[model samples]
Structure formats: C-alpha cells, structure tokens
Target: MLEAIYSHLARRAAMYLWMLVVFVAFGRYFTLTINVSDSLPGTVFLVQKGAKPGKGDLAAFRYNGGGPYERGSLFLKRVAGMSGATVTSHDVGYGYRDYFVDGEFVGRAKPLSKAGKPLKPGPVGLIPEGHYYMAAPNPDSLDSRYALVGWVRDSQIVGRGIRIF
Candidate 1:
C-alpha cells in the first residue's frame, strides 16, 4: 500500500513538471504587464508579440523620446492611427484639445501636463509606414497626444495588450 502511494505521488510530480515545461516553452511569445498609469483601466494584462499591432488594439511599447521619463520604459496605450492615416489636432479651448484620425474626431486632449507645463500637440499628417499613433482612454493621459510620444515605430512595439484583470 505504501509503494502504491509513492508511485502515485511520483507520477503526479512528473506530470506537473511536464506541464511547467510546456508553459515555459510556449510562453516566450507572451508577456505580462501591470498597468500603473490611469491611461487605461489599471489592471494586470497579458501581451502577445506574435503579430503586428493594429488600430484599436492595445499595445505595449518602449518610449524612445527624450524627457524626464526614462528611455526604454514600457508604455501602454491604444493604437489610434496606423500607417497612411492622416492625424490632426486642434485647440478646443478651456485648456483642452481634440484629435482626429482620417478627419474623424477621435477624442479630447489635455493641453497641459499635470506639472502645469504645456503639452506638445501630436503630429499632423499621414503616419509613415511602420509608425503608429497611440492614445489613452483618459484625456489627461500623456500618450501620443504630446510630441514626446507623437508616433511609435513598429520596432518599439513589444506586443498587443489584453486586459486580464
């Protein structure tokens, strides 16, 4: 009876180990991110890097522009405009702005940062190939609305973000 019990335990352990190995091997294509900013709903997310991100997809990317924010820091935002899309913005008064993609109004933008400094407006005109415009759910979010993060290149994309919690 004791031998049978040990044999059962050993088989269970081996199965668990095999499962772990499979997870590790296939999981390399995915990443986990914790949203610390209010740009989107704060939650843990699963990101997949298997394909190119598209407009309306949530994406995780590295910030490559100069600013107080560190380079290579991960930023999560929604893809608002893609290659060949004409992007534009205008002052909407009351310290707020509005953005457009392909002449369709997208969202309102904050004119100033939380520090009270003026935020640079997003780039205007067609987005080049391999470039994307990112936007946040919150109007006050510091995303592609500012020059600091005007457009993201395909090379900077880490993956497509999927909210897990």
Candidate 2:
C-alpha cells in the first residue's frame, strides 16, 4: 500500500512539472488577459506576442499612469495611429478637442476626467517612430487622447490582442 501511494504521488509531481515546462516554453507566444474595465467591447482577449500592428488592432501595453493603475500594469487599448502617421488635434468647442490620425478622426479628448480633474489633450503633428496612438471606444477611458497615456512606446507594447469575448 505504501509503494502504491508513493507511485501515485510521483505521477502527480511529474504531471505538474510537465505542465510548468510547457507553460515556460510557449507562455510568451500566447497569453490570456482579462479586462475588468468596460473600456473596450471584450472582457477576455488572446494575446499574440508576434502579431502585427495596424490601425484598429487591439494592442496590449504596460500602463505608465498615476493613481489607480500602477506603473508596469498591463492595459489593452486600440491602435488608432501608427508610427510616422500625421496626428492632429483641433479644439472643436467647449472643453473638448477632436484628435485625428492622418486627418481621420480617432477620438475626442475630454476636458475633465471621470473624477472631474482637468485633463489636457494629447500631442499633435507626426507621431515619432516606434510609437503609437492608442484609444478606447469608451469616452471615459484613459487613453492616448490625454497626457496620462500620451503615446504608447513600442517597447511598452506587449503584443497584439484578439478579443475572445
């Protein structure tokens, strides 16, 4: 009976070790992220490490913000403008300005945040190389339209995300 128990325990240990090895090998190639915030349409996404970036593609990057979202936290957003694209900001009226990439409307920068804190619009002119403009359909999303999320650096990007739900 003792020998049988030992065999069972060894099998379980080997199974766990095999699973860990598999995860370590292909973990970076694929991952799953859950979005608690309703910033985008999906709550679950499958991240592809080597996926290409394009306009309207979902990109995952590290957050570099203050308060609530800590630095290095992963945040998923939409790719609005790519590198070398001409970005412009126009003060439409009130405390809002419309942002565009290559003259195509991307999103609007709100004058204030959900907390009512005054917010400033993002950058204009050409986007630098290895940088991208990200946004979210939710108006209250803290996207690239504000200084907090200014521009998403290429180094900060983790991968391209595909909505699973």
Candidate 3:
C-alpha cells in the first residue's frame, strides 16, 4: 500500500510539472508582445509597413545612449528632422523664434503661443547622417527636447514597437 501511494504521488507531481511547462510555453509564444510609454496619453497607433516616420515623425526609442536620463533611459519624441534635414533656432541666436524645414516655414513663428505654449523652435544647424532628429510632446518627458540625448541612430532602434498585452 505504501508503494502504491508513493507511485500515485509521483505521477501527480509529474502531471503538475508538465502543466506548468505548457502554461509557460503557451504564454511566451502566443501572449507575449512589446508595449510603449503613455506620454501623449491621447492618440495611439501601430507602425504599419511603409508608414515611415521621417523627419518630424514622433517616435519612441528602445534605450537611452547617455542622454538626459542617463543610460538605458527610454525616449518618446517627434522627428524634429532627419539626416540632412535643415534646422534653425533662436534660443542661442538672441532673437525671435525662426526655423525651417526644406526651406519652408515650420511651426516656428511665435516665441510663446497665447496659451503660453512655447513655439517649437529648431536647432541651429543641419541634422547629421546616420541619425534622426527627435523631440518630446510633453516637456516633462525625457527626450531630445533636453540638451542631453540629441539625435538617435537607426541602429539603436530595437524594433518598431507597439503596445501589446
């Protein structure tokens, strides 16, 4: 009788182990996905193929490369510009706000909007290659808006991520 009881317990333990393995494998393969940050807290969309966000395209980065938030800090920002894209600003010019993209006037017109929203000024030069310009929607978020993390590289991208539960 003791041997019989031991055999039954062993069988039940094996079954439980098998169930655990199946649960873990199923979750990993079927239910696992990536998620993005909730900074804008407004419209959210997926990155479809051919929907490339060029200069001025708001994007999110995988890791911070010694930026304002230190290393490993994630970023969500707009594509202020891109490689070879022109940029201009008045922050260091000691004058009114002025900027242009492809020689066209961008949003840089007024220094401060009526609602106290500062104008989206431009940088004081052309964007370099192998890197993309970026900025944050909210000032509170750590992004290229800060003086630290400037342009991020394409190689730094983990993947065109999406919010998946």
Candidate 4:
C-alpha cells in the first residue's frame, strides 16, 4: 500500500513539474507591453513570439544603433512601408517633410526634434527586401521620419503588438 502511495505522489510531482516547464516557456516567449510613448495611444499590448508583422501592424523591434535614445532599446512603431514598397519624402513647407509610399501620401515627417534640433529624413526609393519602414500617425513622433529609427530589418523584429485594452 505504501509503495502504491509513493508511486502516485511521484506521478503527480512529475505532472506538476511539466506544467511549470510549459508555463515558463510560454512566459519567456510571450510578453505584455504597456505603451507609454505618445507615438501610439496608451494601451496594454499583447506581444506574441515569432509573429510576422506586415504593413499597418504595430511591431516591436530592437533598435540597432543609437541616436536620441539608447541603443539596443526595444521600440514599438507601426509598419508603414513593407518590403518592395517605395518610400519617398518631399518638403511640403515650413521644413516639414511629407512621406509617401507607392505614390500614396502617408504622413508628414517632422524635421525638428522636441528639443528644436534638426532631424535627418528617412531614406527614399524602394524599400529593400527584408526591411520595413515604421511610422506613426502623429507627425511629431520620432519614428522612421528620422534616420535614428530608419528602415527596420525583419531579423530585428521581435513580435506583433496586439492591443489588449
């Protein structure tokens, strides 16, 4: 009888350990993001691992280089132009650069930073394969309009941002 009790306890312990392993795996692969930047509205985002972000999808990626912000920082922005798309910028007026993708007007690029410093405009012409142009509806947002956060590569993409609330 004692042998049977020990066997049952051992099986239950093994099942619990397996459950813990699965939970850890899921938590490590997925994350919840609380967006604090005005680039997008404040919301809780559910980020899934390995999700491919297409045009118009809000994505999180690791910033490769440094500029206004720290390097290796995770940035969240909307995918404006995708692979094989054409992105262009033209000075509309007052030093504002307007962006267009595939001949469609996207948004105006802010030439001045929040501190009144000039910002470098993003690249123009065809977006090479495996890269993406990111932007936000807010013109003042520090996004692809500046060279700091230029075309994001697919390999740098972490996951798609899904608004939870």
Candidate 5:
C-alpha cells in the first residue's frame, strides 16, 4: 500500500510539472502585455519599434495627478501632433473654435475650466523633442491639447493602439 501511494503522489507531481511547463511555453508564445490598470481605463496599445506618430495615432499614457491616479479620471488620448509641431489657438469671439499646430491650423480646443475659453494668446507653441501631443475624441476630455496636461514624453507612452476589437 505504501509503494502504491508513493507512485500515485509521484505521478501527480509529474503531471503538475508538465502543466507548468506547458503554461510557460504558451505564455512565451502568446505574451499578454497590459500596462494600465483601473487608474487608466483605455485599450491596450502595442509598442512599435522606431514608429513615429502622425496626426491620428492613439497614445496611451499614465495621468500624472498630484497624488495617486484616481479611477475613471485618467485617460489615454490620440496623438494630434508630433515633436516640433507648432500649435496655436484662435479666438472666434462667439464660441471660440480655435487651434493650430506646426504653423498649420488644426482645430479648436475647448477649455476644461468654467470659463469655457480656449487657451489664450493664440499660438500654443511647438511640441518638444521626444514628446508627443495628444487630444481626445471626446470634446470634454482633458488632454495635452490644453496647457494643464501639456506635451508628454515618449517614455511616458505605454503603447500605441493596434486593434480596437
């Protein structure tokens, strides 16, 4: 009886070991990489080597709040302008749909403040090196297009949007 029990236990141990090996191999082949948690509720973006974002690349980044990031507050925006791209805002007087980038006009950006005013003095200036400017599809979204968030460095970017589905 003792010999039988030992054999059974050994078989179970070997089975577990085999399962572990299979899991490791599967993980190596199908790597599941996720960067943001509840703090950043956005899609998982894949990092592309030597890839430069143009006007419409979705950028995922961590929101650097004064303290720890609060759930549902942080966001990931799409790349509107790349490094060295100039930005400007125009005051339309009535509603204020004014914004420009890289000496070329883009669009208007509504302020997050109560004033509902766009960034003052028109031209917001050029996007710095190793940094990418971003904006959200949601008009109410607080993004780098505003002065508060500003330009984000490349390192801050967790990844780029690959597939939405």
Candidate 6:
C-alpha cells in the first residue's frame, strides 16, 4: 500500500512539473488571438509563436496604423505574396487599383479609407527578401495593397495562425 501511494504521488508531481514547464517555461511559444475583422475567414486562432509562415499561410503580425487601428495591434492576415514573388498593381478605374502576384490576381485596393482618408496604392514590383504581401478576401481590408500596410517584413511576423473558427 505504501508503494502504491508513493507511485501515485510521484505521478502527480511529474504532472505538475510538466504543467509548470509548459505554462511558465515555454508560455511564449503559444498564443490565442481573436479576430474582430472580416480580413480573415476565422474568428479565433491559435498562433504558434516563432513558426515560420509560408505562402498561403495565415500569419500574425503587429499592426502599424492609426485612425481606428491601434498601433502595435496584433493582426492575422493571409500571406498572399511571398519573398521574391512579383507584385504588380494596375489602375482599375475610379481611383482603384488591382494587385497581382506572380501573374495571379490577389485583390484590389480602394482610393479612400473607411474614414474618408485618401489611400495610396501599395508598392509594385518584385517582393524583396524577408518580406511578404498580405491580403484579405474583403477588399476593404487595409493589407499590403495599400501604403498604410505595405510589405510586411519578416521581423514583423509574429507567428503562424491556425484558425479555430
């Protein structure tokens, strides 16, 4: 009976140790994010911190904007254009521009922001190394198609986002 009790206690101690390591030692490796925008498809995501994002992957980045978008806000967006990929934009009339990556249509950008601010088109040309073009299905999204959210650098990539909803 004593041996059984000791074994149970050991198991409990081991479990607690593992929990402590996971929750405290490596807590920064994982994060939960809630998406409040139509920029992406899901409402919730589990971000794998330090994970390298690839083409077509959902990446989380710290947002740098103003006028409703808080600076340093975490944003989840799609990696539409990868490094070395060609990104081009052409006038689509009515002060709008369409963006393409590697000859594939990515999305379009409007001339004005939701707050009635004039918006400039995103950069056009080859995507530089350590940079990516982010996009969203919703055209109103302030992604890489506009100067406000221009090429997202690798340094800004927070993690790979796995959508939960």
Model-by-model lDDT, in order?
0.84, 0.88, 0.52, 0.84, 0.58, 0.88
On lDDT, the leading prediction is 6
lDDT of 4 at 32: 84
* TM value for model 4: 0.83
Q: Candidate 6: minimum summed lDDT over ten consecutive residues — where?
A: 62-71
Put down candidate 2 lDDT per residue, 12-116, tens digits, no spaces. 998888889999877969899999998899889988886767888999999887746799988899999998999899898898999888989888888987787
| Ten contiguous residues minimizing lDDT sum, candidate 2 | 61-70
Off by over 4 Å in 5: 1-55, 66-74, 94-97, 103-107, 112-123
lDDT of 1 by residue, 20-115 (tens): 998997688888889887889868988897657888999999998576578999888989899999988788788677889888776777777777
TM-score of 6: 0.85
lDDT of 4 by residue, 35-77 (tens): 7777787578888877999888989888877667777777888
Cα deviation at 142, candidate 5, in Å, is 1.1
Q: Can you write out model 6's per-residue Cα lDDT over 28-53, one digit (the tens) per residue?
A: 79898998888777898999999989
Best by TM-score: 2
Candidate 3 — which residues are off by over 4 angstroms?
Answer: 1-39, 42-53, 63-68, 92-123, 161-165
Report the error of model 4 at residue 27, Å: 2.1
lDDT of 6 at 116: 93
The total of clashing pairs for model 4 equals 0
Kindly report which residue stretches of model 6 are placed more than 4 angstroms away from their true locations once superposed: 1-20
TM-score-better candidate, 3 vs 5: 5
Q: Report the lDDT of model 1 for residue 137.
A: 72
Backbone clashes for every candidate come to 0, 0, 2, 0, 3, 0
Off by over 4 Å in 2: 1-5, 11-17, 50-52
For residues 26-144, write the lDDT of model 3, one tens digit per residue.
55533322235444444443432223456655455655544223566545556667788766654435334544545655433334434555544334477777676665444344444
**Model 6 pairs in collision:** none
Q: Give the residue spans of candidate 1 off by over 4 A.
A: 1-13
